[model samples]
Target: MTFDHYGIGHGFDRPGFGEAYFQAQGISAIHVMGRGDDWYQYADMDAAMATVRAATEGAVRVVTYGSSMGGYGALRFADAAGATDALALSPQYSLDPKVAAHERRWSQDFRRIRWRPDSNGPISCSARAVVVYDPIGPDRWHGERIAQDIACHLIRLPYTAHPVTTYLSDAGLLGPLIAGLLDGDFDPQAFRREARRNRSANGIYLGELAASQPRRRVATALSLARRALDVSPGNWHAQVSLARLLSQEGRHDEALSILAVLVQQSDRSLTYVVDLGNAFLHAGLTTEARAIADEVLSRAGDVAHLHAWAAHICWLNGDVADARRLIRRAVTLDAGNRVYLRAIIDYHFGAPYIAGVRGVRVTSWLRLARWMMKAPLRPEPAEAVRRPFPFRRRQDDSASDSAG
Candidate 1:
């Protein structure tokens, strides 16, 4: 069985993720279709689980597989679905803010649904959990949390960012890797060798590596970004990386050209549009930037990051009132994000930064300091694995999955 990432769903009307692939392979699988960005916390969850139990009741070797949000679901429902193996790629330990307060990337989706108590929490199951993640990325937090209480294999791909499967798939390693795990014969050392050898041509990895570099390595970053694009011309991340590098090098026109094409190719994806607007702003095209901001604000819905982008654009345009309003909305939607909170303080109190130092009022600085003091410390990257706990099963026990 296979699960899906957030926003990648084909909707409840279509077959769930990996249905076609599994079918083509002549494998019997049940897919759990998520209706929205609800993190599989369906109103009819009991009914869904009942259906899954019925479909997978007689399976002999069930394995639940997924990436990102789907990965979370695979682990969350493994025991209930009678799964023997749970293969999760970049899974979150929990999406509930109360449980994972350090996670802010999915605040928009988090705000879209009313979180139920204990719906999204740590993995609690008897199955063998195998998690694949980038040890240095945001997922490191979730991976560490999951490992703290449960036994699992942590497959670390450092600096690979969130999409572990994409990186593996690009290197032609995903199929063999998953096959080996399913067959219980995976050789980690050999797999690592192949992964390292193939990574030079992996576009997403190259783009991400470029973005992760410091500004002093701009030349190397640009080279990597160009190589990424050379290998995968349509890669959005690579295009964005190259554009940003160009902008930083004072090549505004080149950056704008890339961003303009990106905005068109992405069908006006808000992030890409915001990048274009920022590019224009940096190019001394205030009118164009303001126009883009107006369009974005009119159509921006509830995404916290989009509002934050609009707020920054507004602030740069000397529209302090709009900036304040927009940033307040962002902070409201994602209250746990310290960066947004700081932006709110800046916009609300007319304390815009000059030369990288905010002219913040003493009281405001004290309040910000208090919040910072309470923030959770991020864990450092390290190879981690927990020996699998013994799972007792009846002689006739069956295995099954609850795929997203």
Candidate 2:
């Protein structure tokens, strides 16, 4: 059985993570999906477990596997489903503020979850467990916590960072490694050698590594980005990295040239659009930035971040009234976003970047500052910005379906 990661889906009928790959191999598998970013902490979780248990009954050997949030789910339900082995890739030990307070990456989702006792508790399993994570990444803390809870083998992929599975997959190691692990013939030394050899060809790894380079080593970063593009031309992330680096070097035309194609090819992806808009703004092309905002807003409504982006563009273009209106809309959509709130306060009372404004309404500004201090530092959910789950069915669809 496999469980899905965070933001993978809100419903089923669409394939769960690894569903297609397992199906193509003629392997019997069941997928446990969660609604929204709930982290499988559904109100009917016990019932969902019952379904999984019933489906796995009399199985010769059961293995639960998943990555990230899915990884957590695999370990969480291993004992309940009578699994012999649980394989988790970049799994969390807990998302509860009290249990894993140091985990700030997924705070937005954490706040949304009404944590039950079982939801974010330590893993307790008789099953043989293996956890894969980047020791240098935030997931190291999570992997360590899982180790503290139970006896489990920890596979540390140093510098691979969070979503280590993506790195492995990009390096053409995931399928083979997973197969070897499941079949009990996995060799860590061999895997590491292959990964090391393939790392240069992995676009995600290359781009991230490039982005992580210090300012003084920007030449090296640019070289790495170009190498990423050279090896993986279709990788938009690599392209974006290259573009951003060019922009950093004041190569505006070159940056715009790269982003222009990306923005066109991305089917108006808000993320890419925002990047392009920011690139324009950075290049002192306010007219182009305004045009991009206008085109996006004409079609893209109900998204907090889009409004925020548009508001920012408008503010820089000296349209304070529209900026204020748009920013307020953004705050209304996502009250917890500190960035949007800060922008609101900045727009009304003038920030450091905006010039020629006397400190007007000092008392109101103080009140807003106090409110900002109390606000949760949460990013707006992707669901709020994009139609992530196009085939969102009934909430109970996964629970009701018979396991494969």
Q: Who wins the lDDT comparison?
A: 2
Name the runs in model 2 displaced over 4 angstroms. 135-137, 158-162, 264-269, 290-307, 337-339, 352-404
TM-score of each: 0.78, 0.78
- Score candidate 2 by lDDT: 0.78
C-alpha lDDT score of every prediction, in listed order: 0.76, 0.78
Best by TM-score: 2
Window of ten residues with lowest summed lDDT in model 2 = 385-394
For candidate 2, the TM-score is 0.78
lDDT score for residue 203 of model 1:
80
